[model samples]
Target chain A: MSWARPLVLGRLVRLAWLLPLAAVGLFTLISLAPIDPVQAYVGDRTALVGSDQRAAIAAAWGLDRPATERFGAWLGGVAQGDLGRSITYDAPVSEVIARRVPASLALIGTAFVTSFVVGTGLGIAAATARGGVGDRILRSLAVVLSASPGFWIAILLIAVFAIALGWLPSCCAAPPGLTLAEVGIGDRLRHLVLPVATLSVVGTAPLILHTRQRLVVFLDGPAAQHLRAHGLTERRIAFGAGLRHAVGPALNLHLAGAGELFGGSVLAETVFAWPGLGQATARAATGADAPLLMGIGLSTLLLVFCGNLAADIAARIADPRLRHPRP
Target chain B: MTLRARDVGLSFAHPGTHPDHAPTRALEGISFDVAPGEVLGIAGSSGAGKSLIAAALAGILPPAALLDGGITLNGTPPSPRDIALAPQRLDALDPLATLGRQIRRLGGRRTDPAALLARVGLTARVARAYPHSLSGGMARRALLATALAGGAAWVVVDEPTVGLDPEAADRVMALLRALAEEGRGLVVISHDLPRLARIATRVLVLQDGRAVETAPAAAFAGDGTGLATAFARRLWQAQIEDPAC
Candidate 1:
């Protein structure tokens, strides 16, 4: 080929099914949930409402239609950028998400960056130093944290920082005060501290493990052995060839783990009462707001799809072997 | 400068020795010398110490191995500046780099990828390709380029023709001959005795990690009668007896 093909186009084509498949799965599971959004919307008046009134409400909401029809209609509305109105917020689902996007962006973005930097750094250090005390400690810590659930860590942090020490608020994104822009950096940072930490503490473990594993393969493998025989210092060969070879696999694992990280955002956001899609998702579920729940589910699935695409593109950029479609 | 191994012996930790970790000898009574312009071939069967000796000469023996006798490149201990080893594996090529980029990196101050590829019997077009895209012969030559990148005076090539076709193997052997002609000491470890004999000035026979016989390449002649030891002769006899095997 005289001109190099756009690998991203090929990657996207390969990955195009991820979003639709995940949407179907999410819609199916949500539909199967035993939530009575109509009954929840009616509240205490369920006792007083006549059967005809109830039937009218159900039919109006298209709940009287077959599940396949309802899902199809909802999916069609989603394609038109209408995520339906929230029964709980008494507003458009998009508006509720819009009001909360900044909080999610600020929190998840910080978590995403912090987890990668710290995790990869620790992993490199541990691998290079192999049997050192630091590696031993970090490896054990990674094992424990990888298995630890997100909410458990959040609750633990709350117990220590908020209850026992009384140093920070137990919940909520910020103290009841002026808007976020008006709040000083110190106040904003304090509000950010717990949730970001909660996500990071649990999130960084898999990255560290994956990076270390890849580094070991690169450093200890036959290729490394061959490099050493070429009269270069161990440190130079390791930093040069080792890092270059390890980056592709390590980044792949990191990206794969990143998709699932959104799940943790839900627990982290709820624990701190941060007004993100995470917390909104929980509240929607609790209120049995089917439309709002579906909207949040779709958004989270889209984020995962984007993350996977980003990783594939990133891999292509970093390594030429991944650039072209495999023959 | 001559590369010499004087009664070189290596041992490794063995719990069989008792409560105290005593080393068990893996290689013993190994000795040889290769001068500039000489191609010294080492031959051995499976589980013999051929690759280990290659690694030791390049100062890359496993950490558990302990050395008794010294190895000297130009009367100093073996170091990367004077010695290089091209191992069997080609996957060691950095997958992230283009052939030219990797060649340049390995070449250090000798940074002309086009020149290096030409020297290794490859065209400049080969430089633009990734390691995986290169054919088996091209990859081997590229690795040879990497091994010679630092311009080491002595090169140890372990199983350089392991997976090559006859034509590619001939090309690699010819390249080794050309390098030897350039006055660099070369050591080749291989099971292919006929190929080694075609280029090697002298061949060192090894069995069970010990030097069995040191013979001029011409001595591996008809019926193996010219060989110095029965073990070396028997090995040749086996190959001659069962050429299909």
Candidate 2:
């Protein structure tokens, strides 16, 4: 089959099935919950009063219908870029997401880039220095970072750097307050440090260890021996040939790690008081804000999908054999 | 240009001696030379140091082999680019790379792989195909193309036609002759004496890590009691008589 057809069709199939399934499952669970959506929104079950008042409120939000009908309506609204209204904020779900997404994107984007660059570089170094003191040091550091909880690390970092050293502001530091240009690059980066570092430290360990292990394995394979015999320099064989072969698996790990980053960032955001999706999701969950909760879930799903897609594209580029049958 | 291994002695040292597990003496006092434009075929039983001699000549013997002699190419130390060996196995080529690229790499030629493939009796279409995709004979030919592409003065070809059909073997033998005629020295290592006799100018018989006989191809055949017949007889006796006894 032609490449383009499979690529487009695969994505289309994922969107066609997965979105509806997620929406239906989420809507059903929200509907069946013991907490009343009206009470959850208004903070008073008694305000949803007489039979007429209850019917009007339910009708306005299509909650008066059967479960299946309500789910279908929600799915249809999603198709038209309407993610429904926030039961708590009384705003459009898309508007809330749009307002909040930039903060989360910026935070996650910085964290992702930092983790990949630092982690991959360290992994290569560790693999090259396998069985040496450098490898031992890196392995120990990776184990420690990987084992520590993101919240604990965040708190320790805040205590040491923010409270003790007074190197950065403790909490709720506005991006513009420390900048002359409304949002100076330095100010943004400084504000991003604690959260990004927390996420990177937590996320980087597995990546470093995975890349290092994969590199060592590739070096031991027959392909490496053949390359060595071809009169290629050892450096060329190791970094050029070996690294290229190991990238596919490393990239898959990277994508999976990126998905986990969203979940892990909740603690970091909560500790740092960073106004990102994880914090938003946590607050919405505590208050039983179903629409906001669903909004966060949908955005997280989209981020994961995009990350996996990027990894697939990278794999195809790195090894054309993935796209074409070996012949 | 000539390729020579002078009094080459290679031994593997063992920490403790056991009668059944003695240190292997792969090559011992081996001395031979391949003159320009000559095909020197070495025939030996397995563990007779045929491969060790080949590795010594190509300057690729393992560190554990422990050489106590000298190998030279045109009176100078062997450089990596000076020697090329068509390994015994056909899939010796990289599975990830195209046959043409491999040929270009081996040939050390800046020419297109299609041109190189043409020299190996393969069409230009074969250039993009990988080694795994080729037939046994085709893979051998591609390997030969790689070895010959480097334009090396000498090639240490180990069993060039091992698993090939008669036709493929003939083609490969013919290609080696053409390479020899182009003033390149060829070392054809194989047990198939008939095939070697067809191409070699001189034939050497290696037994127990020593050159037991060295003669011109015509002399070896004219003697009527050739190395080929002798080796065959030994193999038959080992397979038939020794097993029964």
Candidate 3:
């Protein structure tokens, strides 16, 4: 029973090489683009410039060297925790990302937890009431939500909740002069309502459907019958037995979906004017700020990698069949 | 403790468009008693509800099947914890869990499983193996160990030696006899007349969900006057009559 070896080793090897390769490739392509950084800063590509000025600018940014030499310097800087300074922001790329990363991480983390809890609970309820009105209604809701595009759903929610109802501010406001710890739970929840709800509602459908399908299949298995025959309480059997068996596939999907949430949050931040990585990326992309763009891309890659890694570990923990193989 | 089923009947609801879709009776007016420390062997042809009786004694009848009469163990209805049943199919064991864990789950103790497995002629090494890693006989023995692990007052073993070599069957029957001598009631359900005679003290004959005869194990040994002989004679006559034995 030693199945975990090949799986862990294969994933580790891919992560060690493929991720660095992807990051290097992205850095190269963005650096070699035909756009001029000075013109991008000046907002006029045809603006006349002296050769000495261009040479000084190229030397200052280390772009005067060959592409290989430049990439090597950049890679070495990355290895030394320097990530280089953003030409547009005039600050360290790491510092800019560090300040905004927490906000985006908080938003996506809350959304992931909210979606997982609500979706799995609804799925179990629907499964227990299968072929009944509850199941039908749940199925209809899941299908509708799953088919609706996330951007459209986010717009619809904003229009109804923010514009029509006027319950909360439509965009980011001042933090109300409260420390992060001093912010009342209710007040924080009120502020987070739109973003968290939007993210969770858009992400919940697949999780709900997967959980319901897996639970129904598990209920039909021999282990379920064995538990029933053991005189375990129905509630215990449903949650303890049913959920334990169903958690593996549900978790894998949920974790994969959690990684996609970062991408969704980028769009969502742009739409809602939320101060997060997506907004920062949009600002950088609009200005063709290569350093800032690279920083955001690398940050997003890290988030996605961490999400998937957590998911793999959770799946292994949930499924003994995966952790141990027959000898 | 004694187990008694008084005129027990089980019927299944038939699904159809017809208005008069009465329930199909699987067992009808079946009455029998398994005394303490005695082995009662039930013999019947296929579809005679022999296994249903085992299920009833274990209090695990299917949801669709309705019980008509009472089934009492030790003068009370049987509870899941009090009775153990070994199903005919070895696939009932979970393929994912180790054999030791499955047995421990049933008994809720570690010591009993190893002892029970040893009693059923299984080695200590086999206890750690999965069901797929076991041979057919070893799987059956593991299943029996699981049944006996709970110190069940009565064990309803359904076709314990159905697909085993003669040596394995002897080992299983010897284990059952030993359990019976320890003052636990044993109900052995099988179609093998001679094997049942070897382990069973009393034999009960079932036909079409009805008990036709009850006699001592020796009654079927000499003359064909006992239930086993009568069951075989009925089968032979039915084959001669319909050619579908």
Candidate 4:
């Protein structure tokens, strides 16, 4: 547990630098886009607005300023705990993010937990049956699922369960034009099913493949042999000694893959029209909502940093060698 | 009852990583026996298949290795649990487990971890340490202790004293000797022929995975005069005259 202290402090230091760097990077990338923020905000009314009105709008939003000046203003506001405002939504960036974060968390949290549990189980099964039919089938499934794009799978699920069978809604976190107060719990969960399943399938693939690969090596290693020699059955050795040995590497692999999982969630959100940070990010990127994008970018960097740190702490708990220095 | 490897042979697939590979013979025509209260020492230079023989005896051969003939106890194939192998590689110990927990797991709930560690000349504190925290010598002793704790009828120990200081090495040899004296069969594999000769009832010398000689321990006498094979004589002489000695 002592390892957690230094590990967390070190990550916090890295994160302090990462948040600003990510904000600047997102601001720069979004700035390079051809879409005009005022044009996006006004939509088809862009032609109706006169040059005078456009100039007033650009001045009001500070879009008329130099990129460096706008970035400096944004950074200064962030240092003072202000996240600026979303030009697209006509709301504070922080407020928009707060409203959307729970939706994203519900989606990513359910999907990620499912992926971890199911992927780890499948991986253990495959490794325990390495070179057998079950191993081959699981490995093949992992390959196909991992290689396919997340949105593609989302569309496929929508096609089968939503459009084809009409078993579930095709898209969106709630029925069109419905407020949170109007939607029932069952309806909300019904709307969630496809996207969560899609993200879970996408996230689970790499975990299964990685866990199986790492665990197979461990199952064939000296520790497994030692366990076998001690009179334990194969099943006992695989679940007992082999699982403990392989889990640390598998967890680290999963955490190292946080970037991909985040990227996949974005794709899933766009396809399913989920009202989450990912969907907001997509809309913000296209609408040239610099402030909103900056807020989301910083939040994402923070989430990923926290996730990796949590994984490090968990792995140390699993393997004591990681907790103490080699004597 | 005795532990026996009768005409036992082992061949691992070459280019082991590949699906299509040829079997490369590692050990063949290897035969020996260790009855209760007897110690059989297996000695050879590096790459002589000494460890392979130990793996064969313990029934922990790699999946790629094709084993021929048989290793038996009391005239039948023994269950894997009946043989305890303390592998040469320190990595064989469960890295995630404390020495005490692993001892309890292998030795059963009733077996006292501290008592077992003390028997191997380790402190009770050592039982609480993870494998990686131990020195190489400590790891080796810990491994031996775990093997002993298994309480297997047949114990196969590979290079049990490779990293130990002289005194610790002697202590390990004595502990193994005591096990044999207590009517447990042991197959002690080592490059330290001299130390092995001290306790081994019979020493089987291996060359390129084949047994070159199986002689009574007393045969490794002055100037290696009693050693039967010329190769065995030179091997004995070389160890005796080595600069390390």
**DockQ of each model against the real complex?**
0.66, 0.26, 0.29, 0.71
Of candidate 2 chain B, the 10-residue stretch with the lowest lDDT total is B236-245
In the range A41-82, model 4's lDDT, one tens digit per residue, is 778886799889988999999999999999999889988999
**Across residues B55-119, which tens digit of lDDT does each residue of candidate 3 receive?**
77776677677888988886788888777888787876766567787777777755556677888
lDDT per residue, candidate 3, A1-327, as tens digits?
255567767777877897688778887777777777766665653457666777787688776778778678777888888887887777898998887787787778788889888888888888877779999999899999889887888788889998999886556522555555676667666667788777787678987888889888766665555545555566765676577656667778888666578878877777777677767877777665677787788777766776687677777766655565556
The DockQ for candidate 3, computed on C-alphas, is 0.29
Q: Between the candidate structures 2 and 4, which one is better when assessed by lDDT?
A: 4
- Candidate 1 ranges with C-alpha deviation above 4 Å: A1-28, A38-76, A163-170, A318-327, B15-22, B237-245
Q: Which candidate number would show the highest TM-score if scored against the true structure? A: 4
lDDT of 1 by residue, A201-291 (tens): 7668877887788888878888777777776666876688777666666676567666567778888998888878889888888777778
The i-RMS of every model, in angstroms, reads 1.6, 3.1, 2.8, 1.4
Candidate 2 chain A weakest lDDT stretch, 10 residues: A172-181
Model 1, residue A182: C-alpha shift (Å): 1.8
Give the C-alpha miss distance for residue A95 in model 3, angstroms.
Answer: 2.8
TM-score of each: 0.90, 0.80, 0.78, 0.92
Model 2 per-residue lDDT tens digits across residues A151-266: 88888888999889989754542543442247657776778888888888866898889888988876655455444444556676667656765556667778766778888777
- The candidates, ranked best first by TM-score, are 4, 1, 2, 3
Show the colliding residue pairs in model 4. Answer: none
Model 2 lDDT per residue over B42-76, tens place: 87688788877766766555545788877888787
Looking at model 1 chain B, report the run of 10 residues with the lowest lDDT sum: B236-245
